[model samples]
Target: MSLGMACALASACCFGIASVLQAVAARAVEAGSASGVDPVLLLRVLRQWRYAAGLALDALGFLLQVTALRSLPLYAVGASLAASLAVTAVVASWLLEARLSTAEWAAVATMCAGLAMIVPASGAQGQHPGPAALRWSLLGLALVVLLIGALAGRFADRPRALLLGLGAGAGLGVVEVAIRLVESLTSSWRGV
Candidate 1:
């Protein structure tokens, strides 16, 4: 396999393993009286060795993902990242002894098959530097997310959780494009 593919797979593996570690750590720590999204609970989880290892793996995964992005197209990288779900399922099955349904196994197979097709067919990364406006728009989105997060407490528990999830998803999407755009911008500035 190519270096990009290797990096992508390694990144996925790191993320998958990290997921299990973090989940285990989260469960190990008992929560306090706060019924909502408790910062203290998060802090407690942070103290766990498993969580620390998970965080380290997450950082490593991100770096490997960036390396993969430098060589592979965004879609290909995305598909490869999706492979993390498959890895997570497998890892969870093994470590957590979580029983997988036949459908779930089938889904994993389908995902793996799709990845097999994607990695081999993917071309080198495209050179287009995205529009300048994207940067400002992303900033705007981030500010909006922050506003939503600040106002989240106003809503009921379910709504607050939903709002936070939406905000997080949007924030992650922003990161997705921003990382590539930043890379493009840097490469352009370097005249590479």
Candidate 2:
């Protein structure tokens, strides 16, 4: 449990810092040169040191997240990941030199409070092998998300952010489910 908690926290911190770095790099790019969803923007961002660092952090975060997911319940892992927003808020204030209003600080506190409540209630990952139907459903969902993201490529920045954010959230959710599914499969294989 302690290791899981550590991994989760590490994941959150890495993701938070990465987000701020990536955002800063993206913002530095000139506007009106390319669509928000353009691959060229990614190429441009990659030229920035901040973006490259952010990508490295993202890779580290993903490993930590997987470690956490293996040991903790999906709910616990999910909540911790969601709490990355609070980490982002802090990182933005410190590294990005952004001011946090009183209300924003309170919101971060609220998020921490909520996480405190969740961690205690969370248990070990369940042993049950979820239904095959669920796996198929998740696959379908992934395909649908890819389609939506492709379509969103034509959209402007504001709408593109919303769509991409939603897609990313969904992708993370799918990762949680996939972890559970893998656990179930491993358990079943061991039983055999």
Candidate 3:
């Protein structure tokens, strides 16, 4: 649990820093040169050093997240990941020279307090081999999400952005749950 907590916090920090770096890179691009949905903009952003560094950080965060998921309950890891928003807020304030109102600071504090409450109540990862039906359901959901995301690609900028963001979040959530399911299946197999 302690190790999981450490990994979770590290993951949050990496993700937070990466977000700011990516934002800096994005902001450097020429405004109005391309639409928000333009794939060329991704290529442009990838050429920036900050963007590369952000990608490296994101990779590290992903590894840390996997480690945390293996050792901690989904809820606990989820809470830690959610706290990354607070970390991003702070990083943006410092690095981007963005100002945070008093209310924003209070919200950050509230997020921290909520995380503190969650950690103590979270127990170790469960050993149960979740039903095969659950794994199939997850697989089905992933396929459906992929279809929706593909359809969303045909929309205008704002709607596409919203749908893509929603799809990404759902995909990540599914990955988290799938990790646990995989672990359970593997452990069960080894015992057979």
Q: Pick the candidate with the highest TM-score.
A: 3
Q: Estimate, for each residue in 87-184, the C-alpha lDDT of model 1 and write its tens digit.
A: 99999898788999999999999999999899779977767878889888988998999999999989998899999999987876777677777865
- By lDDT, the candidates rank as 3, 1, 2
What TM-score do all the candidates reach, one by one?
A: 0.86, 0.85, 0.90
What lDDT would candidate 3 get against the real structure? 0.90
Lowest summed lDDT over 10 consecutive residues: which window, candidate 1? 31-40
Q: After superposition, how far is residue 155 of candidate 3 from its true place, in Å?
A: 1.2
- Please identify model 3 stretches exceeding 4 Å from their true place: 31-34, 184-192
Predicted candidate 2 versus true structure: per-residue lDDT over 55-124, tens digit per residue: 9999999989888888888878888888889999999999889999999999999999998887778876
Better of 2 and 3 by lDDT: 3
For residue 99, model 3's alpha carbon misses the true position, in angstroms, by 0.1
Candidate 1 residue pairs in backbone clash: none
Winner on TM-score between 2 and 3 is 3
Better-scoring candidate (TM-score), 1 or 2: 1
Record all residue pairs in model 2 with backbone atoms less than 3 Å apart, i.e. clashing: none
Count of backbone clashes, every candidate in sequence: 0, 0, 0
lDDT of each: 0.87, 0.85, 0.90
Clashing pairs in 3: none
Q: How close is candidate 2 to the true structure, as a TM-score?
A: 0.85
Please give, for residues 5-60, the per-residue lDDT of candidate 3 as tens digits.
Answer: 88998999999999999999998985545454456888889999999999999999
